[model samples]
Target: MRRNGNSDRLSPIRVYEWMPVEALNTLLKQLEKEKRSLENQVKYSALRLEQESKDYHKTSRERCTYLAERSQVSGSYQVSKRQQMDQLPRMKENLVKTGRCNSVNQKTMNAMRGPVKKISRSNHLPKLNL
Candidate 1:
């Protein structure tokens, strides 16, 4: 090969010999920097995934607790409703008995007041013939 000062035409062996020590050192430093950057990215991705998993589990637990509490409250409400329904007939019977007692009380009150009669004004005045 002729010594043409063009770098593109240099043979592999000549290129290796021609590369400066400083250039090789800079390339190695850049490769190490890139490797460290890749490692940090992988570590960050792993931490993020772990955090997401924890959040998901926490929300799932909260959802379960909320559902359990809601079910308990609804169950109590249903039991109270059933108890009210069961007592409906008794309540109606008590009302009917009270109505009958009220009729008797009203008769006694009227009896105490005495029988009502119509009175005329002439009955209070003495009879005088003109």
Candidate 2:
């Protein structure tokens, strides 16, 4: 009995049985090769991602340390007396009259112009004749 052209309606089992055994084996080998190749690509990408993540973390840590050191260097200079001040201009003026605000800068003249005392031992201690 000759069937009409309806090969697309064949069942999966019928389709496999219709193909030659050597053709099926060749297809299987090709599919396995593709699977191995894909697996190797996946491994390569994973390793690369891990290496990049490590580098990112290391750079982040180094950046944080560098910023901290820089802040320490700049913070060493006292810009203000404290976090807050209790008095206004009136109190500040009184403090200046009492010689309390001598450390604060209100004049344009240099503060380091004060006389520099000699650092020799004679100025520190009384000269005792041995």
Candidate 3:
């Protein structure tokens, strides 16, 4: 046999008559306390999320700054290296002109060797019989 839904369900007045006032009051207070606790948890969770977002953004900015500085340093080093490489041919030409790699120039050789002193030669008269 199918049960009647209306007969199975208790009306508000019947429920109130069955449950004592003290029990209903206690249940209401417990529910209110739980609601307040849940609200506080929600607020704490929101604040924690906001703080984590701020920390994430701060670290991201710091990382970007570090990468930019590293790239600039690397770029500067590359430029300096390129400049030195570009001067290679000119340095070779200078070496060739200075005769350091080929026949040496007397002036340049003398300047590189420092000052030279000349010794005076004096002949003393000595007769030897052959």
Q: Report the lDDT tens digits of candidate 2 across residue range 24-80.
A: 999899999999999999999999999999999999999999999988876764434
Candidate 2 accuracy as lDDT: 0.77
Please identify model 1 stretches exceeding 4 Å from their true place: 1-19, 100-130
Give a tens-digit lDDT track for model 1, residues 6-124. 75566665865778999878878999999999999999999999999999999999999999999999999999999999998888778767864345445445576764455578889
TM-score of 1: 0.57
Quote model 2's TM-score.
0.49
Highest TM-score model number: 3
Better of 1 and 2 by TM-score: 1
Mark the regions of model 3 whose C-alpha exceeds 4 Å error after superposition.
1-17, 92-130
Alpha-carbon deviation at 53 in model 3, angstroms? 1.2
TM-score of each: 0.57, 0.49, 0.58
lDDT digits (tens) for residues 1-130 of candidate 3: 8668885685655776789899989989999999999999999999999999999999999999999999999999999999999998899789878867543444344666764444455445566799
Model 1, residue 49: distance off in Å is: 1.6
User: What RMSD does model 2 have?
Assistant: 11.5
Please give the RMSD to the true structure for each candidate, in Å: 13.4, 11.5, 12.1
